[model samples]
Target: MASVQKETIIDADPADVWAVIGDFIDGPTRMAPGFVTNSRLEEPEVRIVTFADGTVAHERLIARDDQTRRIVYSVVGGTMHPTHDNASMQVFPHSEGRSRFVWIRDMQPDDLAIEVGAGMGHGLSVFKQTMESPR
Candidate 1:
């Protein structure tokens, strides 16, 4: 499996960041508005998201831990044909009122790595700005 990992420091509290990132349904759009055009909950833990490129993806929420400020999910179906796609995001307290956000994705067929890694890089950059900007 190929994996992509990204980390960023946001000038916000961990809980504050988690509050937005943890909301599986609306989080993507709110956390990375330009990248994720739309996100809606299909079921309790399933979500259908529309990307900026107009590609739609169905993801299932695997786990959410408030205490650890972490969330895990899998891409069940999407434009890309990957044998497997699992991703996770976690937030850690960096300093006074600052947070470190980490995003990781594991997929098969190694070729998927470049696309996912690039997406995560852009997503994380936007996420950091969205989180640090005035609320």
Candidate 2:
């Protein structure tokens, strides 16, 4: 199984980042507009997030720890043409004023580094910038 981990430092406070992270359906509401066009919250911690590429993903918020500022999401069920099964994303907070967001898993049909890299790289940057951006 291949693992990809990346980190970025944001100027925003932990709480600020947490707030953005908790946005759930509107996580990208405060992002750099045109990035996350639309996001619809579904039943039972599920959400259908629409991206700029017109790509939509049905994700599930399986776990969330307010005390730890952690959130776990998975794309086991989505609207993608091929759909991503057995995939997940975790967002947690650490440090005085920082957060640790990770996307790790052995989603089937491995060996797609380029595709994964692009998504991860862009997702991290966008999430970081959105969280750090002044309110």
Candidate 3:
């Protein structure tokens, strides 16, 4: 299995960050607008996400904890078919007006780790830019 973790501190309140990421259905589009072109819920627990690079993924929500500001999901089907793919995003309070955003992805087939990690890195960068921008 390949496990990749990426984290960054955003210059925003934890609650504010949660408000954006907690939506699950629309969070990706909002968090990384250009990177994630569109995201919609196929069902209560299933989401279909379209990326800017023409990659689409059907992700199922595994868990969501409001108190802990964490959301877990798994990609069931998409352009890149993997035996196992699970990911989680969480926000933690940092300083008075900053929050730490952490993203972790675990998947089968170690070779995919590099590509997946690069995507995660780019996504996080866009997310940080979006969150820090004036709203």
Candidate 4:
């Protein structure tokens, strides 16, 4: 499997970041407003999201741990090469009122690494900006 991991220091409280990320359905659209244009909940653990770049993906929630501030999901169907893809996002206390945000994706077909990595990079950048911006 091809894996990509991206981490960033978010200038916000870990709980605040988790609150945004833990929503599962409305989370992406609200947390990264522009990056994720729309999100529709198909079920309690499934969502369909449309991205800023006009890509659509169907994702299923794998696990969400409130105590650990972590969420795990898998791309069941998508425009991207998805032989198999599983992703996880976790938030940890970094410092006073700051959080360490980590996003990781594991997918098949190594050739798609560049595309997935770039998308993740942009998403993380947007997430940081959105989380740190005045609410």
Give lDDT for model 2.
0.63
**lDDT agreement of model 4 with the native:** 0.91
By lDDT, who's the top model here?
A: 3
Query: Per-residue lDDT of 1-135 in model 1, one digit per residue for the tens?
Result: 999999999999999999988999999998999899999988878999998988788999999999999999999986877899999999999999999999999999899899889988988999999988886
Provide the TM-score for each candidate, comma-separated.
0.97, 0.75, 0.98, 0.96
Task: Show model 1 residue runs off by greater than 4 Å.
Answer: none
lDDT agreement of model 1 with the native: 0.92
lDDT of 2 by residue, 1-135 (tens): 445556666666666766666666777545435666777787868888777877677777777666665566766455453334434344455676766665554444456445656766787778777666666
Please give the ranking of all candidate structures by lDDT, highest first, separated by commas: 3, 1, 4, 2
Candidate 4 C-alpha error for residue 50, in Å: 0.4
Query: What RMSD value applies to candidate 4?
Result: 0.9
State which candidate, 1 or 2, has the greater TM-score: 1
> For model 1, which pairs clash?
none
lDDT of 3 by residue, 71-117 (tens): 99999997988899999999999999999999999999888899999
Clash counts per candidate, in order, are 0, 0, 0, 0
Alpha carbon lDDT of each predicted model = 0.92, 0.63, 0.95, 0.91
Clashing pairs in 4: none
Report lDDT (Cα) of residue 85, candidate 1.
Answer: 92
- Model 4, range 44-121, lDDT digits (tens) per residue? 789999999999999999999999999999999867658989999999999999999999999988877889999889
* Weakest 10 consecutive residues of candidate 1 by summed lDDT: 75-84
